[model samples]
Target: MSDMTMTAAVEAALPKAPFEGRHLIDGIWRGSDNGESFDRTSPSHGILVSRSARAGRAETEAAIGAARKAFDDGRWSRISGKERATLLLKVADLIEANVERMALLETLESGKPISQARGEISGAADLWRYAASLARTMHGDSHNSLGEDMLAMVLKEPIGVVSIITPWNFPFWILSQKLPFALAAGCTCVIKPSEMTPSTTVILGELLLQAGLPVGVVNIVLGFGQPVGALMAEHPDVDMVSFTGSTAVGKAIAAAASVTLKKVALELGGKNPQVVFPDADLESAADAITFGVYFNAGECCNSGSRIIVHEDIADTLVEKVVALSKKVAFGDPLNPETQVGAIISQAHQEKIAGYVKDALAAGARVKLGGAPVSHPGLPGRFFAPTVVTGVTADMAIAREEVFGPVLSVLTFRTLEEAIALTNDAAYGLSAGVWSENVHTCLAFARRAEAGTVWTNTWMDGFPEVAFGGYKQSGQGRENGHYGLEEFLEIKSVVMRVGRTRSNWVRA
Candidate 1:
């Protein structure tokens, strides 16, 4: 009676692998100190997929020690940027060669559509290429003028050993975002991917090895947030730490890194807003807005979950949005027709669902969907795309990052109010404004609290444009020269011909 395609079943029923995650120390893969491991399941089908290392403090120490040795030994950082770029490009080629496999793994782990995963995988490959291209361009500074006989210059160098912790939503995307830039700046790394999704990172390690990178230059350690992640954060050997996850975790990592004065770059969570003006194209806005939040099942950092619409057009836009939301077919991630896929897991589904229920309790209206779908004989944790109308600034759905297919709608009387409403949250990753007025667009773009403000778009990313957040959204930008700068530190060397110390005051 079901019309499910064979591709769907093949994807949903792929045989799982083993507990294969290992600590990549000294250019080799080794198990955790105690061989401890944990299993991760496919959220789309509720089946076991792989077991990763449950790394503890001991394994963590080995990774840190290895990184220290690599930095001290001058194997990677001492190398030229062109050589590093070559190796990085080699890695990119390997990734491009095996993108399909990586895409499938990502889809299995995150329950995102296979097509979307394919695009993400492809995008990651491009990211590596982009990093490679920028590698040769990372330059320091040259200055002279101390007493006319002195010459001074500055050198931008690696921040020493780095620890990059990525998230489940985008294992490869975030890892590539951090790794290439660090390597381009001549720093080695110890990567700890999300325990929920480690397969792609594991394979990435393999590709790096094939790319002929120096031993101990890059290490992959699998672990959760407690001992392994905590140890890596506070580890003295790790001079810098980069994380892409929740704001809560970013704060903790930042605090831990503070003890050692380590450089930390965080791409944390967001509760971004999308504003729609009365004079704007409601249809285009509706389409963009719908896809903006509902894409990736609304699990993006800049989901535009909060929509501030002009009160005059609020009613029409709501209906357009509702109708548009209903047409996004959801069933199988493999099918290109499926616009929405499964939630990450039952717990996550319930978490997003809980927000919807709480919104209803707070007198919000469910304009489209607010519950999970029922598929007989299939135990997938799938939540229908949900839209919450009549949302207030104080509501939980508006304040917190639901991180699901849930959108909270609000009304604004004018552009100033809209800007105020959008900036009311602690996040400032990205925002969108739909208006034809150039002044209005410029005003909102300048005033929006977020770092990236789109005049008439959402979720659009490029390798050249700079992106990051302010306030609680996170620290430091990713993409472009700004992104490369995040992985580097500037050190000035002052030269003086007349070396005697001279002061206005005599001792």
Candidate 2:
């Protein structure tokens, strides 16, 4: 499509006005004390999309104080499981009801396809619902058989106030992953959404309020990491910090939170790989590989950005993947038919192009697109779907995350070689193996170092399954019951029955 035609279509779909957002502290919506604010322009449309309050140290500390008071006062932390579950379910209902509103804003701010953004928002509702179920089922253990005179009990309790920092790629969904689960576990929280995509999270705060969440139980401060996020991580009142972003930032948050010995949960970067075998379904594998790389334009932490294929079928697999990549639509995110959307920002676009350029300079071959694309009407930045061949384990493109719709192809001669190449990177977020043979799939699944392994598939996620990473990818899991446990602490109690305990001191 011509750039002008695309631009016209996108412009027609743009919202009449940008969203206005503010911090939610102690159940009240308010602007930054200094009246500071920041605006976000749609990366695809090149128009203003949101203006959010820019929080500073004072706002950050206020949010922390509110959460701390809420937790200590038992406003939410001591609530009944049934009560917490009821409120969470209401929030889930609200999320579903507002899917269209949230999704449109998300697509505008994050530059993901509208369909994908809708799916993310809808999927987030399920996370909230799953967390509600967890609230009801959460339990502790009783040691009735320990002894007649000495009985014991193991209890699970909320870990107190939590600092939740979410990323822009999946702002609403990632926040849902942490917030609802923390609430379900009886932990009050202070959230800091990525400044680039802060609207959807603010809208979520509205839903939370409508759900009748207790005052001070959930607070949000919108701003950059320096004053807002850094304070959240370092606050002594925060019992734990849950962050999802780059590995470097995760490390910094961990270090800052370490001074107080607070618990830290990080979901960081990934250079996830999908291994293709000679006996695998080439067509399915190729399609999945294309989808995996292009989904969210490859901004996902679990993105199958790299692939290790059996040397014998490497050429055939690459050919099939390139063909599929060409078929996937790429354009403005507002267009529902568009499969891959704009780059998140100009800087990120440059980063992606630089990776492909460096790979070519380092002797790698571009099987498909290797440059930026321009559409007539859209003012946003876009990159062509890229496929780089001749990628070796040692190349930066092979190990580092390009975070664009780019794929790196590496060849392996044997199962051992494929596994070695898959685990060669510092990240162990996710891995996939495509083979019809059950034994081969089992072997790969058992050996892959990633937190989640897919056989005959890629990126199939569920609220029932736990998601996270290993090694540098991250620490701690999100989703399912394990997600709820991340916000909880264990306590053991021992008691003497009927005053049967004896004193050791000679009194």
Per-candidate Cα lDDT values, in order, are 0.84, 0.91
Put down candidate 2 lDDT per residue, 1-507, tens digits, no spaces.
321113224545667787999999999999999999999999988899999999999999999999999999898888799999999999999999999999999999998889999998988889999999999999999898877887898999999999999999999989989999999999999999999999999998898898899889999999999988889988899999999999999999999999999999999999999999999999999999999998998988988999999989999999998877877888878888888888888899999999999999999999888888887667788888889999988899999988998899999998999889988889999999999999999999999999999999888889989999999999999998999999999999988889876788879
Candidate of highest lDDT: 2
User: Over 4 Å off in model 2, which ranges?
Assistant: 1-13
Which residue pairs in candidate 2 collide?
3-375, 3-376, 3-377, 4-376, 4-377, 7-377
Backbone clash pairs in model 1 (N, Cα, C under 3 Å; residues 3+ apart or in different chains), count: 0
Residue 504 lDDT, candidate 1, scale 0-100: 75
lDDT for each residue of candidate 1 in 232-316, tens digit (9 for 90 to 100): 8998889998999999999999999999998899999999888999888888999998888888888889787889999999989
